[model samples]
Target: MTTDHRTHARVAVVTGGSRGIGRAVCERLAQNGLAVVVNYARDAAAAKETVATITAAGGRAVSVQADVADENAVTALFDRAEQEFGGVDVVVNAAGRLALSPIADLDLEVLDAVLRTNLRGTFVVAQRAARRLRAGGSFVAFSTSVVATRFPAYGAYVASKGAIESITLILARELRGRDITVNTVAPGPTATDLFLDGKGPEQIEQLAKAPPLERLGTPQDIARVVAFLTSSEGHWINGQILRANGGMV
Candidate 1:
């Protein structure tokens, strides 16, 4: 474990921090002077690279491996943060899985996997964070604009995200008076491997045009929103689902 002795600095645990939007969030939060615990389900190399980027920039971070869906693993992930950095002040549940298929054609197995990772995983992580995060902490969960778009072939993915939004609001209320804000980030067509995979140029172009900004959102764009919601200025904005997409809905 990489330890940062800055006792007053805020500590953040970002799941799926090894790649894509999760990686961007880890970097952004670290830049904001937070001691970050970068969590990854697998891909140790990618997780290491994320930590390297943060440390290279004079930020403190450590990469931990855990399956978000597993309660025990999630607990250990949080424990590592408290042990190494003092206490957790921010948690970004960016760990998720996506499966595309129209409801009629969706495989039960794929839907099960998506639900397990996106929905159940969010619950498991949120449960732990709710219990352990110090006062003034914040929890950010990821959702999708497709929930409103009702895009075909996205039933399973959207269903999982929808549940995330629901739980986010409820969790925020449950934490009332804790000074810990809980919110969900719903991003529209973002430029990441997760969004680009299985998408052709035409489909990608169409999505890019859907947003008023006329382009796919970058990982950094989404990261900025997460940063704000975790910051002191964003403390008052709790139990909200922020749509980071460029006016797509």
Candidate 2:
């Protein structure tokens, strides 16, 4: 899946590139002629596999370990990206965790995890990208479509992503004079492990039928959009929450 005649080869850092949407982003960016650094928090083997995929396909990439929520680790991750790939050109904050619990039974620990990983983690990564990215670069943040649909057990998770959407506005303003753009991608319920875990057959059927597009989104679907948002063609698209949720909700 090599891209055609990429004018400028840039360096991109994709957090949580070990699996799901993150892996898809890494593969797409690598194919688009960027030397990507695939950052993973815990899945070392999966991270390496993404790297291998890129390398095997004749693209340049590396697997780096970092918890995007941890400031120190994130700083180190950015530093390493600069050291290894020259400088960071794009940053995609795709790493996230989802916990389902009703508000009454919502574990405080689960709430903390959700906030730390999705909101705070995205902030840390986006801030670094804003400060470190070169002119003409871009920063993309991930938010879930659940924020729009507002399912029952997804309250906390949606809240965290909602916070991401809020922060994206601020970050875009902060990138003012620089040619860099900041935006959020709100994906509809996709068929990722994080999304379809406990759904029974009936629930799955209902969900698949609910969306106007009549199917769950694939990683490749979201990945292609992320690639576009980070590309030169997306320069004018800033401070917008682009929803890629198959017209759902």
Candidate 3:
């Protein structure tokens, strides 16, 4: 696709946009003529690099540091976006952390952190977006294929994403009078740094082969779908969970 930079671009705020899927989503939105507010939790340097990448490519972008789990920080993030880009047209909640352990072995601290970051964080961000979305705005949240497959050791993560899916529906109805759409993108096992750890080449190969496509997904693959969902073309889709997992069940 061609990247046509515009003088006055639409505004978008993306969480966890410093690396991996978040970075790709930011780049794709920028290429599609949107000024991106790239939000990061702790990786300021990486977030800056993402912003630089977009700017160098003739697209507009800025890096903002905010922990999604914190309501104050999330409020600050939206305030900064509005101050910088006028008003936000698209909001993507892709910032999340994954911890895998059997329910028996799970630590309360780990569970709490996961819930705060994945569940509470999404609520805060989505609520903020719902309040500020433009007339035809869009809100995209993230889920995982593990929710469907019920993968062992993923109970906590799945529970969080399940909450995300439920919230998407609730928020969509809550905004019935508005033209905005709220949805979820549930990606299957992709070839991301977060998904590749503790696994070797053979393990990676096995995971990739599990998908019908015979390969793991790339960040770009997911980003393209997200771009469409937030763009004018996807305006008709609302309160849906579109899974981009290379056809993995």
Which candidate comes out best when scored by lDDT?
1
lDDT of each: 0.93, 0.90, 0.91
TM-score of each prediction = 0.97, 0.96, 0.96
Residue pairs with colliding backbones in model 1 are: none
lDDT of model 3 at position 235: 82
TM-score of 2: 0.96
Instruction: Evaluate candidate 3 by giving its C-alpha RMSD to the native, one decimal.
Output: 1.9
Residue pairs with clashing backbones, model 3: none
Q: Looking at model 2, which ten-residue stretch has the lowest summed lDDT? A: 1-10
Backbone clashes in model 2, listed as residue pairs? none
* Candidate 3: tens digits of C-alpha lDDT, residues 30-100: 98888899999989999999999999988888999999989999999999999998988899999998999
Off by over 4 Å in 2: 1-8
TM-score of 1: 0.97
lDDT of 2 at 208: 80
Q: Give candidate 3 misplaced runs (Cα > 4 Å).
A: 1-8
Once all C-alphas are superposed, what RMSD does model 2 give against the true structure?
1.5
